[model samples]
Target: MSRKTDPLIVRRLRGEERVLEVGIGDRTGVAARLVDAGIDVRATDVRPVAAPEGVRFRVEDVTAVDEPDAFHRVDTVYALNCPAELHRPIRDLAAAVGATFRFTTLGYEAPSIPVERETLGGGDTPRLTLYTATTRDGTPRGSR
Candidate 1:
């Protein structure tokens, strides 16, 4: 059986925009697929990484990035397997990188992963929901 991907993740790409994948594993299958579809992709991790050709790779921490205008008008930001506490950081990264779309994946239950409801500073922390603007078929219900 073939595993299905979340359609909202890739149905509207113009095939030539810059995309950033944060917390990407050793090999970025999504990035590869997007590149095959003609998008310019970039992969970044907290530590070292060796990226494939045609995909620019960076070694930087998503939470503490300090580069000014470091990206080339990023269209999308993918953060798979990221902890809920990291959501704000991811949001900051996307904003810093100029990403218009942000995609993230999380588990359904608590304790399965470290999803802290209260941030370290204190306040009602928002859960890392996918922003659910699109359907399973990738038809967006509203604009971002």
Candidate 2:
């Protein structure tokens, strides 16, 4: 079976070793695609839920990241349709674990942190904004 992917997510993360999907309530599309692409995908949620085969699922709350070890050395930490309220915690979590942080918003809210944005899709596909949580000691990595 072919796994459906968020083209943008898979595009950015496809070659990475491992990924942590934050707040994966019931949506499995992203995880499935990652797994299919041979990336080790682990997912977390506040509730006890299951992921598709090949994905490691755990109950985790990014807002209060307790088991930092569970995230150690992961390539990335991402969430779909994340809210502004969650931007800080997960960004902190990813930074603490030395992983790249990325997410998409629900369209009704703005990012609460400094981020590098990318526009996803073209032509017939619907456009969505993808944000990479970043630092600006200067500025985001991709920007001069």
Candidate 3:
């Protein structure tokens, strides 16, 4: 199947030093595309995952007791088709790590955290709406 999550994320995150792709459940190409763009990508899921070429995979529960180490180095943290329940936790993780946090929600679920919406599509590119978390500070909510 084609990865609905692609180039847009790659497009938006250009020039980042490193990034974390959270809840990469079956949407592995998101990280893959980020990698092709020369961004360092590390993806995580609660369970183990098969990483794409040039992408690093980790088993992580963002809501777990210990923080995921990937946070320390990444400049951005994002998820695609993230469920409503995870919006806050993931955004909080990004906040704690001083990373810019963003996500796209499942169609029916309203965002549970503050966000700025962006529409990503026009022509052959599939239309996708993505949410970038807005933190309390001037920075993106997740970033310090």
lDDT of 3 by residue, 24-135 (tens): 8776877877788888998889988788988888887888725645444588888888899999888878877778887888888888988888888768878888888995
Q: TM-scores across all candidates?
A: 0.63, 0.87, 0.87
Clashing residue pairs in candidate 1 are none
Query: Which runs in model 3 stand beyond 4 Å of their true positions?
Result: 1-5, 68-72, 136-139, 142-144
Candidate 2 structure quality by residue, lDDT tens digits, 1-144: 112237657877887888998888778888888899999999998998878899888887778766688644487888898989998898888887778888888778888999988887667766677888879762542222
The number of clashing residue pairs in model 2 is: 0
Q: What's the CA RMSD for each of the models?
A: 10.5, 3.7, 2.3
Q: Report the alpha-carbon TM-score of model 1 versus the true structure.
A: 0.63
TM-score: which is higher, 1 or 3? 3
- Cα lDDT of candidate 1 equals 0.55
Shift in Å, residue 82, candidate 1: 2.2
Clashes of 1: 0
TM-score of 3: 0.87
Where model 1 places Cα greater than 4 Å from the true spot, the runs are: 1-3, 6-8, 12-16, 109-144
Clashing pairs in 2: none
Task: Summarize candidate 1's per-residue lDDT along 1-144 as a digit string, tens digits.
Answer: 001342334443445377877777674666667777788888888888767667788887776776635553476666665666666666555655556434454565232222223111114332333432233355432224
Question: Each candidate: what lDDT?
Answer: 0.55, 0.79, 0.79
